[model samples]
Target: MIKPTLDEEKKETKFSKKYWKYDGLHVISFTKAGLREENQDGISIEFELNDKLKESDDRLKGYYLFGVYDGHGEHGDKISDDCVEHLSKYIAKRLYELPIVENEKEIKNAIKKGFDDTENYFKTHDINGIKGNKVRMSGTTALTVMMTPKKNLYIAFVGDSSVFFMSSNKSKKINIEHNCHNQNELLRLRALRQKGFMYSIKARSGRKYLRVKDDLSNEIQYTRSFSDFYIKNFFSGGLIAEPEIIDKVYSAFNLDLLVLASDGITDRSKIFNKHPTEIYLSYLKRYKGDPNRFVKACDEMIKLCDSITEKRICVDDMSIIIIIILNGKSEDEWCHIVTKNAEDPEDWDNTTHEDELSDIDDQDIYNQNSNEVDDFLVSVPLSTIPIEYYDEDSAMNFTISDDDNFD
Candidate 1:
């Protein structure tokens, strides 16, 4: 049995925004604090697999893990930071403990245990001098993906953060957002018999949306998350840490792009009511097979979100991770191949639609003065906040050239 090596782990700390290029993967990530004093978002990108696993299955070679953690509440930053440091380690430990790597179920179980163990750690230990009560009130949403050498992707997530895959000039959402607005989530909450579990709240645009309320009267938009122990204890099965896992297999030529983003980027209010994936795919199409222009496209997208934040349309931290699957080819070669294989723009579904915010009952709580809503919708403009940029090499087998410096 081969033990996991700490020396090979390439995990970055919270808010380390940079670009990384590996053997067959190119990653560009950015995280900015929007209208908030502190950036509560955390990111982790790691590439590590023991030699034994690679020998057991060729598909396991060159496996890499990346995740985005979006935290909420007073101590949100602390909880997200802890997740960045510990969650990947727990997952790796579970994989190492397995004697035989057979099917996707074993791998999915390992990933699930990682989420459970991370939640248990927070439940038992005090974080950054924060007591159990404070820790219980704070939590984060996690979206993680592990990609293997054979183009197999294992995606697991909780809360509203999302993952998308783009190939053959088409886009597909890979994970479901766990929130009250989702019908399946509503059904689960109803089965629990948690009173006042669903309520309506108005956004800055006067658009009302359904949110889940706990026994403590805290309005939560997400139905599942890590931590929030206070709400979990207040109501029966109020919030959970269990993650939904799914696997996708893509051919080398068809795997063009993978995106992992927080709700700030995907939310309808921030992006002109179009699905974020549609907007992202359109941007990639505009670049026209130019690898050098890909980063610029990402910058433009983030700046669009940042501009909205500055106008106080919607104020929430934003983070995005864009991974270009190279399939062992050069960056330029990969871009040209994707462009050649893509379909016409006219055939794409890029229409903008109105949000379904009026589906809830009129008798439900019209929460205009919820404390949680007030705290999240504060008026700290993004213009007043400085953006931090890091240009150092943060990943193994990745190069940083002078021309490739961050703007």
Candidate 2:
């Protein structure tokens, strides 16, 4: 496994000034703490395939993985940090063990097994000497994308973090957000007989948030995640670790760029009037032919999000990874290709300006209420049930069985 160098780690912990190249991709990532004292966000960028896997199959030679984790609750920081360290290794290990790295189905199943192993480990192992059950209250949302040598993309995720795809023709949101407010997610919970799970909690600042209250009455924002074993143990169907997967081929979608980020980047704010995708595309168009200026474009986007938290209420911690797909061309050669096919600047700008912000509502902009309730909630803790409510059972031991259904 290839780990980040000490210098690279320091640069990522702060803000990255330049983009790092990995095979056919140029990547730049940033993560900064918001109003919270601790930053619970984490990112993973793995470029090299395992030596064993490369020797096993030539098709796996250029495999790469990228992910972002957004943690919540008391031990949120540790959960996200561990996820960054463990998830990629688990997935890669599973792939290496496969007899043959054949097709998309084999790769997808490997990713799912990796998630299951990671979840089971957290459910049973002690983190920082904290017992597994107590640590179960903390969890994180994960979004991961794997790119094969053939340029096929396999995306899998749980929770609100997202991956946005941008091409010359169109831009699209790739992963589904798993939250209580999501209609389909709500319907799924309702079908499972999880009634009264949805409610709006009013913060001291009077900003109300719609959240999912588990059987134990622990309020949570995400409907699916890793390490939130408290709810998963009680009502496994309610909050799961299973991730939704989607595949994209290079020929099907001529993707030029991919943006993976936490909800902090997509959160509604007074400063950003349009969709985040539109705003990013606009910046890309402004610096079409210049590869160096593209780095500045990403910096400006993060700065804009930072400006929002400073001017208005404290938003969630922001983490973003901007990827430029180089294919087989040099950076300058790819830039020229995009420039030649780029739409007129006026046309792109006018389209974004004319488009109405119909997708998001003003009140429903922010889903996480961490910053608004940090003060009072910290002083007066919510009452809890007896320990018997979290009684240990064989199921809690996390032995994966053939009948184990996380779907």
Q: Cα lDDT of all candidates, in order?
A: 0.63, 0.62
lDDT for each residue of candidate 1 in 1-407, tens digit (9 for 90 to 100): 32221112223333445677666666877787776677888787777654423435534345677899999988998899899888888887777776554457787888899899898988898989989688888999899998655556788888888887777656767666776445566567666653544322222223322221222235566778888888787665757888878655444446678888887777532235444545555556668667556666676677677666554444677788888877677766766665554444345433322232222111111234342324432111122222221112221111111210011
Question: How many steric overlaps are in each model, in order?
Answer: 0, 0
Return the TM-score for each candidate structure: 0.73, 0.74
RMSD of each: 13.3, 9.7
Model 2: residues >4 Å from true position, as ranges? 1-18, 51-60, 99-101, 132-134, 194-218, 247-253, 268-277, 285-291, 329-333, 336-407
TM-score of 2: 0.74
